[model samples]
Target chain A: MSETRQINVSKSQVPKLAIIALGIIFAAGLFVVGFDQGHIFSLVYGEQAFTDMYLHELTHDMRHAAGFPCH
Target chain B: MKTSLFIIIVLLSGAFAGLIHGTVNFAIVEPYLDQAIGIENQNLFASGEEEDTTEFWVEYEGYRTWQKSGQILAGMILGISVGALFGIVFALSRNALPGNNDVKKSLILSGIMWLTLYIIPFLKYPANPPTVGDGETVVLRAILYLSFIAISGFGAVGFYQLSKKLKDNKKIIALVGYGVFISAVFIAMPENPDELTAPMDLVNEFRFMSVLGVTSFWASIGIILGLFWRKLSSQKETTHYN
Candidate 1:
């Protein structure tokens, strides 16, 4: 393909790529939410709910792996 | 055109994501098992002989309900309002010639706007010792307000920065910064049982989750609308360019 045509093709693909990335992020988020059901409850409540649920769950899992009583 | 549409798509997608994810576990997955287990009574600790329920349970339930409803409503309103406001601000800021330092101006303006709406309220009502139901009610209400403001403000900043950095290597930096701010708030949350003035009513949790779901859904809608507007404008520009 000519350089101009290559650029056009790549430009057209940006939106498609963004959509795919978003889908992956959303799926990962759901998985995190499902895994941390208990903490999800806590995070949903007023005090702690403002925090990103995904990060909290990941941190909790890490803590558990490192032998912390995250529960 | 692409940027606006991207914003809208992200907002809508995030909202639906929140709602579906929030409901799936409680409404379907867990409830099915609970039902299959043949649960005799959900609340096992309730004393059968009690004539008047204890004030703790009563206050807890009341505050819980209030928090849930307040959060949902706040989330929806905040998400849309903030999203639109951010989009307009972003569009206007970017309209300036490239390399003009107007991005900093826009960021500063947004920061001021956020501080005025989100932070001032907390400053007005600093976190106090847990009072009776009154304290719980007050704090929960404050939290809902703060959450809406913060989400909208931070989301906008993230969106704006993401737009600017779309072609730059710093896109991840912008996204991660917002992510860290949000995660820090969660981590810093005081988890002491005493700090929780409200009782842990399971029903209340469901209610709160529902509100969050709705908020996420609407915020996404706002983003979608904003994207549409941007797309239309961009198409006009493209036609002119052609």
Candidate 2:
């Protein structure tokens, strides 16, 4: 039987990969937290008033504070 | 200081500043909004035939609930996330800017960023409450606002690049030139007014508060981060810097 070995990766590539991951994560976070207007929540809830209201309640202050449209 | 460490500190500092700013906004603006612009219901009973028609009033459950804890939490989150993103960009652009401390440089950079990224676009299309404006016009309004932001951003970068040729007061000259250019664009762009649903004063107040909250957050982030970075730099030894 051949001995198993770990996959080799370039050391310099680690930081580059981490940076890309960070960017992607942060971009998604900003979109969800700031710019999302019930689009995500609506998927599961089917565009109900309660869904919008709940999301709005959670984000309304942040939206105005961060200079995003809330109304 | 290590760049990653510096980024973390800047993000935390921004969050702190944003917390304070958000607290103030929640305390003052929330109450004002609640009292001034709480509901917008049309009169069902009163007909146009009625000689003495009273104002229509309908209390709504509304979207947002005023909660102190929620506001504070949101504020801190806003500061950290948005600040971190901006902070990274600010750090990357540090070479192009001048300053002993990255944090202090951030102050000037953030100011320029705000001017171009937000204020310019905002001037053309002032922020409205969530309930304001016709629903159909949302797309057109968004396009217009985005275009304005893009113009301001590119114009600013162009000005900065051009200012490199000038030796004396480069920043001031670039700012003046950009301001003039933005002003011209502002004048040329036709006004796209939306139907006002809320009371004018209430709408204006909300707009003012929104601008104030954002401005305060940026100002605090700059100052707090600057102080923290300077303090860290003083404690550090002679380091390898590019």
Candidate 3:
């Protein structure tokens, strides 16, 4: 008589939803800090946002320091 | 898999690292930024775009303070964002990474990412302080820079995947392959259209400081995340880690 052994292992699959959420966070954060030039504020404040450039001004130092192109 | 815990740890690690990055920049990089902006102010006065008057100085100081404060706030934001990406990659690649423990593996990944994502693109388009970039070419420069980063990151991942298919002894070919691929792409990419008007010494010094700030962020994230993973990843919760 031959005996067959059984084994169960959990590799712990990564959740797709978590990755998706992180991806969104990554994109939004990068855009706000690295690339935003008042476009985000414009959605609510209109053309005046371009002149104010609140977020742009806030992230200005880092934008330059982290190597994103700035004027 | 303790999904909520993973996310929390990732965000926390990123926020802390980003805080360190922002603080380091405030200490070291701020001087260079102030110097460069001073040059910009001089140019503004020369071109009659802005007057050297009390009102102008008041407004400038106010905005400069705001910008300075933003360094830390933006650092936190950027940290969480980049940390999220790092977390995702670490979770996916933990099994295959070369290290005896979580910290070492995380550090190895960080080094690889720092080299491919930061160092490589930096060589092609180094960091520039205020008064260096052209307003008209800003968009183009941004696009070029982002494109290069994307190419390097994905190319590295692609080469790594190729390496997995080969025998252990043949893995070096993948490294060589990526080196050749990235070098060719580096040459093929277009150069920055803007002329460098800033002093070579100032620009070079600013770049050195900038590298230090970013390096700090990567290293911090690696250590913090590694510690978290090792501590939280108990045998009962995540069977694979055992």
i-RMS values of the candidates, in order? 14.8, 12.5, 6.4
TM-score of each: 0.31, 0.72, 0.94
* Docking quality category of candidate 1 according to DockQ thresholds: incorrect
Worst 10 residues of 1 chain B by lDDT: B124-133
Residue B119 Cα positional deviation in candidate 2, in Å, after optimal superposition:
2.5
Give the range where candidate 1 chain A is weakest over 10 consecutive residues by summed lDDT. A61-70
Instruction: Please tell me the TM-score of chain A for candidate 1.
Output: 0.30
DockQ of each: 0.03, 0.13, 0.40
- The most accurate candidate by DockQ is 3
- lDDT tens digits, residue span A3-61, model 3: 55444343557888889988899899999999998999999999999899999999999
lDDT of 3 by residue, B39-126 (tens): 9999999999999999999999999999999999999999998999899999899888999988999999988989998999999999
lDDT of 2 at B98: 77
- Candidate with the larger DockQ of 1 and 3: 3
Superposed Cα deviation of residue A33, candidate 2 (Å)? 4.3
Residue-by-residue lDDT tens digits, candidate 2, B126-229: 87764565546654665676578778888988998888888875668987999899999888876655677667787788788878877887788777877776
* CAPRI tier of model 3: acceptable
Q: How do all the candidates rank in terms of TM-score, highest first? A: 3, 2, 1
